[model samples]
Target: MRCETIREALSARIDGELEPIAPGALDRHMATCAECRSWYRRASSLHRTLAAQPEPPVPDLAADILRHLPPDAPLSSAS
Candidate 1:
């Protein structure tokens, strides 16, 4: 795959969201492309940082948030 395509797929690849071809293409491109490798490192690092920080809502916390919504409001994904 081309650099443009690889760049587009890098984040998805890092997130394990890519189809098989995209991940393989990402790996192959990273091997030979320093720029993409650096991009992948930065993207991976940020993903890890953000992923680690979003503590899942405790049951009580979810309930509390839900309690504050309008009575007719649909329950969010939180509930």
Candidate 2:
């Protein structure tokens, strides 16, 4: 796969969203591509760190905060 294609799918790869074939291809590309490898390393580190953390207790204002957010605002996919 091309570098651009692999980069576009990087988030999915980090999230374990890619199918077996695509992930294998992405892993091979990362092995050979320094830039992509670095990106993968960073993303993998973040995934591990986040995974290690316990979910925070929900605040009483959580629903209020969500209610105040603009409906049209783009939500981040990371959550």
Using TM-score, give the best candidate's number: 1
lDDT of each: 0.77, 0.79
TM-score of each: 0.57, 0.54
For 21-59, candidate 2 gives per-residue lDDT tens digits of 466787788889999888777888988999999999876
Write the residue-wise lDDT of candidate 1 on 1-79 in tens digits: 6777787787667777844454565677789999988888898999889988978775658777778889998665585
Model 2 spans > 4 angstroms off = 19-21, 59-79
TM-score of 1: 0.57
Cα miss at 53, model 2 (Å)?
1.7
Off by over 4 Å in 1: 20-22, 55-79
Top candidate by lDDT: 2
Lowest-sum lDDT 10-residue window in model 2: 13-22
Scored against the true structure, residue 2 in model 2 reaches a CA lDDT of 72
